[model samples]
Target: MTDTKNEQQWERTISFADGGTRLDKFWGRELADEGVSRGRVKAWIESGLAKVNGRVVDKGKYKLAAGEKTVIGAAEPEAGEGAPDPVRGRLDVLFEDAAMLMVCKPAGLTTHPAPGEPGPTLVNLLLHRWPDIAADKSGMDEQRPGIVHRLDKDTSGVMAVARTEAARLKLSADFAEHNVFKVYLALVHGVPTPAQGTVDAPMGRHPSQKTKMAVVDKGGREARSDYRVLWTGPRGLASLVAVRIHTGRTHQIRVHMAHIGHPLLGDAVYGPRESAEWERRPDLLAGLAPRQMLHAFYLSVFHPETGEPVTRWLPPPEDFCALLAGLPRECLRVGVVGMPGGGKSALMRFLGAMGRPCFSADECVAELYNPGGDGAAMINQRFGGAYTLEDGGVDKPGLFAAMRESDQVRREVNDMVHPMVRHRCEEFFKAHRDEPVAYAEVPLLLEGGWHKEGMVDLVAGVRCPADKRTGELRRLRNLPPEILAVFDSWQWPEKDKLAACDFVADNSAGLDHLEREAERLDAAALAALADRDRATEAWMDGLWPGLAGELDRERAGGEGPA
Candidate 1:
């Protein structure tokens, strides 16, 4: 029926040859030799030990699709004793009153015991540490004892446990009435648009798969969750989001996030797979997350005995923080803007040599003007193909002539190309998110409003003196004097651009002088990035003082307790 690897555990992957068979029935027939009966299989399903296509399916009566892979991990010797042995370990006690206690639950520790499963769960440890909790008869099951609510085995966060029957009842009522508040920190695959919103949906057990939950229209209970994005990584690859749920349904955060197209990273069951941006970039996903990136970082509730408000919070576990560290941090984006011949490209080259990724708007435009490219297609559609070259490409000279002849034609081209150029620049930054700084050489950076659009973090203006401006233009492009004035007239004045920008490079000086300025700017940018990271850490520490000390001790090689 199943291959036994050891005396403690057994696992098997099976594919149904025929469709429409009940999952439990199929498992019962296959695992008969392993001494696993149909009833045991059902229990295991409810415990989320049975999976189909890597997703937990708790329903025994779920109809199977032909060739669907079903995997079952079963305990070798089924659980018989109702009471599990006390587990001796360290507990992260957050807050404790006479009525209730709050603690930080670590990942991989079950909140309670279940049939056919044997392990040192959170309850077992709690019982060992606080023997009085064992005497409290308030939980739904004897194994749970004072456990008022539960977190998934893989979710690490602050949890409340009742110390007495009165506390348990009050806390239960508070949870049922949606009085307790929970703030979860999750790292999701994509940045949710608008940064913050609410999800109001109905949730219920899957009609066929009894073990799994889904958003349903009929016979489902009301569920609501509010979320806001805290930070986004390069190219919107991942986001740190805060989630608050008014109602606790099974897998509510995971399911609701998947529904909104920004599934939590590393959540195999409900995470995005087919539509994931990092689907093809295994290197980027590697070391990103080992488990679902969800943590119950904060919880607030009324004291069961005194009716006083109590709040407790914990910083995310080491793994969760590690995952965040592995991701690319927000890189400093610097936009280089100036008149056509004001040495923007030279400055970009200097920065690029200094290990900063740089984007050239002219290069991007040239790439887009290739035959059959998006820019070429749009240009042809809008201009009746009159500016197209013999090779089905846009003739740059012809387009320039058109721009000079008519301001409307110039405006139309600018409207179309500026957006394309900006998008390309954005992708460049995303691709190099790991870098400390990046530069975009945009001739019309100010005119296009790239800085205000949140596309760039800072702007560097190239200022050239009036006498040297015409000489520089002659040396750079050898354009006619009239053409130079026209191009220069179109751009913001040197003083205005410099005033609006965070930094300015005097291009009137030679290459040596500009290089020195570039180096200074590089150091300043690096320091700014470090300051930002420190500020973020300070904010997190302020939010969770208890966890901050724990993290400090952990970093200092003090593994305080289990």
Candidate 2:
């Protein structure tokens, strides 16, 4: 009876005994297992889904000839005039098979056409691509033919739809039985205590606000949600939470989370637009939100035809990532670097006086070079007392002589000291991880490559003319010009360092000018620490050619369905 073994394809060969069979009547018997009517088969044939001997045959009454091949393309349901108009736009299909398909539903797009959201919905897009999804109308809503479940208009995530009536019934039953897996990511007001917990609440229509759902005590259905705090923003301003729902109800997540007093950020319906948490840094937390911050990050279901498990996961969209970027770090790490005698220490002192925690790399080196210290022992072992003093401390003058004489000596000494300095810096960061701001004065931050690493969030370079730097060193440390040259040779050119820095301060004009520059740099550094606009721009640029483009094309009236 079948010409092909592929389950996705339906083909039959006419036998001499079965000649003169009407196309529709033949298909009606052939697809009786699908429980579809002859009228449906007639529609499929007219739609050019049926072919005779590799040629399309639209007439249902066309008689089959002996030994002629009859093949049917994928079935598509006949659409009614009242049905949604098919709009040919790219759909984000995750997985598709003969019986079902999974797709990523973007936020701000309604799942299907409704009185409130008329036309141009996901269903319309689906119909254009898979007309057969509309084939089985038995007990199906004209507005929502193959849809099994839905995400809120403002909630984006993965969803599954059936391609056939049997598949639809099975999937619907699975969802109703709570056998499906669903996970969501929500940006909420504050971190929930105990880190993880469950919310068991009853939900019903709000008595006062008929348009909203709420946790009601009377005439409500059971709802349960489990959540874990994934990350907390600076100052406990906001938190990213992963939530799993055990029961599906209208606005169950929004209502349950709100009932627990940690409403989702930018949720104006259930959450107050004004709050102390938001008032602290509204721009970073909620002001940038285009809608309530909720994403259906993951979904798992069983295949209707094969009973195989199907799971799909999608990262949050561009806008969600942009909001995530807005969550500020707990501490703003500032790395100060410049040439010798460039007044880096002066800037460090200024920041310290302003109550910022400060760490000095030079001071860390000094401690390491102390008598019986790790640096002293390593130097004594490597050069065999060549750079060691009588008290087991580093002989600074001798070490400088060796460094000036041999390049290998200089590199070995530096290689050993850089990691120690970085370790101390890591310790400093850990100590001040809860602080708002911190400063690290690293003389060779750029030379040692610590600035580019994740050791610091921002780098500030202090620049001074060589002549001016020499005079300052002469006045302060009483160092000669030749020694300054050696220090300068070990570091990058002043201009190059300044070019790589996030911020720069000019110390050539003296302390009053340097102090003014420091003040400006401090303000700018703080702002940079809080700013997430750069990340948002990057995300938007990357998304414009992908998912964002699809939404734009649909809004601009994409081509009609083929």
Candidate 3:
């Protein structure tokens, strides 16, 4: 029979990379094994059910980095491989009694039975030694019998378990609120920017792509992290970072630090390119570190019953030191549609400055029709030298007439120029790998199938009321109103551009204002990045060693001899 009194305990190694996450979320997508979706993950975050390191993280998009030990409500699942037994050797009991028990959990033990996983986990050991402790929490989750928090499989840590239902509820509640404190030791790749500082950025789901966390500007929940540089390594290539989290998010540390261009060495997922960790440090996993160079060392929180601070300490697993020290982890083709002299050039210039790498339709045509540049010689052969400049440049007006009136000529021109333009763009993107954001501002971002390809982020039109636009156009180029109408007819309206752009800046303001707006955007981008890292640090440091030790004990016993 299920015990109505204090019954059950939760502990295990919890890695964000693991199938069942140590982190808890009322609404976010469950880990792959948990069988939840992004929408559900969102629900968890919004409802304040998701948390890391025992603090509320109401955002579904928060992350769980390696070496994180997260304590949550009773609903928290047993993430990762923890069969019920500590290593198949002797057990170390810190405290034991009929009402309760606490143990210094060895790394490498499974907490309970998982599907298709028939091995002795911590639960198996409990059943073998203390038959009366079984309370049957299988109804909550199949894998996790009775759980409060999880340590990663390789993180050695301590844990507490309730012998009765009342004890279980109270313990879970204590962890849910920040009544618990956890600490971790991470052998990171580089020293943190400041000797001691906090990371405070909101966490959110990655956009555009799925299956990861991102430091988002909008639609995220608060995350705070604090860290201090412990010491530089003998070689100075690495350092120890001591961290604490005011809030928890999944993969918070790894993602936040990576966003700032530094990835935890030996971490594959959420890290820099795979080449850095794989090719550069092929011997990493074999030497001193068996797992990632991270360890959860301490956890402290107010004891629910005693109303006093209770702290737990653990040590880094041998595997953590075995790994080699280093690990490295636009635009639519716009066709200009406008009256013959409708400030198209000026508009194009404005769009370009906004960080869009635009490809002007006018420019495309000119380049294509250049001598020896696809249509250059062809234009000369078809139209003669007078129309085609000596330098082999095409006459824009002349070429337009021919292409519009003669489909054959248009086809011929397209045949030569279209392919070349496409190739150039491909090369351009390859070279601009360092740019975080990219865009293209063409007069006709929508005219061609360019924007349809989902390449362009936005369409911005530098426009003014007809009277003002006409006057400006006339001053720039001597074109008649009648001629300009045909040109402008194809041009998209200002309202249309507004609807199309993800964001819009009214260049209608003075030049100084426009510059200010750009600066504002730049500042905002940097600020967001900074805030994200801070928040992640808070979550990272939240990984107290108390739970990590339990996880490490489970993993060592479960896996084959390493």
Model number with the top lDDT: 2
Q: By lDDT, highest first, what's the ranking?
A: 2, 1, 3
- The sequence of per-residue lDDT tens digits that candidate 2 reaches over residues 184-249 is 889888777868999998876677776688887766666899898877875476788888787778
Among residues 3 or more apart in sequence or in different chains, the pairs in candidate 1 whose N, CA or C atoms overlap within 3 Å are 58-211, 59-210, 59-211
Per-residue lDDT of candidate 1, residues 1-562 (tens digit)? 1222322333222323436778888777655544567787788788776765335688888887643445666533232345556789989999987789999899888887653345678988988887777643333234456776778888999999888766766676566556677778898987898799999999876666655678878756679999988778755768888888888777899888887888888787776473344455545445557678899987877788887667767879888887776565567788888877777777788888987888998999998899977899889989989998777789988998899889999999998988888788878887776677888888888887777878887888888777777886566777788887778777788778888898877777899988987887778778877887886666555645754443345323622111
Better of 1 and 3 by TM-score: 1
Q: Mind giving the per-residue lDDT tens digits that candidate 3 earns over 1-562? A: 1111121222323432442442444223223223455555555556654445434566544555443333332344333332243224455665555544555555566555533335556655655555555434322222333355555444455566555444544555554443455555666666668777777888766775455677878766567666666666422446666566555565666666666555555555666473254445323222344344445565554444655444446545445433322221011222333333434455445546777454555566566776667667666776556458667777877776776667787677666665566555544543342344333334545554555674433333344456755675466677666656655565566677556654444444455655554444444444543554455445335543424554345333533111
Clashing pairs for predicted structure model 2, backbone only: 76-132, 77-132, 77-135
lDDT of 2: 0.75
Error of 3 at 541 (Å): 22
Candidate 3 wrongly placed segments (more than 4 Å): 1-92, 95-121, 136-143, 205-211, 272-275, 282-286, 321-562
Q: Model 2: residues >4 Å from true position, as ranges?
A: 1-80, 135-139, 274-286, 329-562
Instruction: Evaluate model 3: give its TM-score.
Output: 0.41
After superposition, the stretches of candidate 1 with alpha carbons farther than 4 Å from their true spots are: 1-82, 97-100, 115-118, 131-142, 163-183, 187-200, 222-246, 257-262, 278-286, 300-311, 319-328, 543-562
What TM-score number comes out for model 1?
A: 0.74
Index of the highest-TM-score prediction:
1
All models: lDDT?
0.74, 0.75, 0.50
Give the Cα RMSD of candidate 3. Answer: 20.5
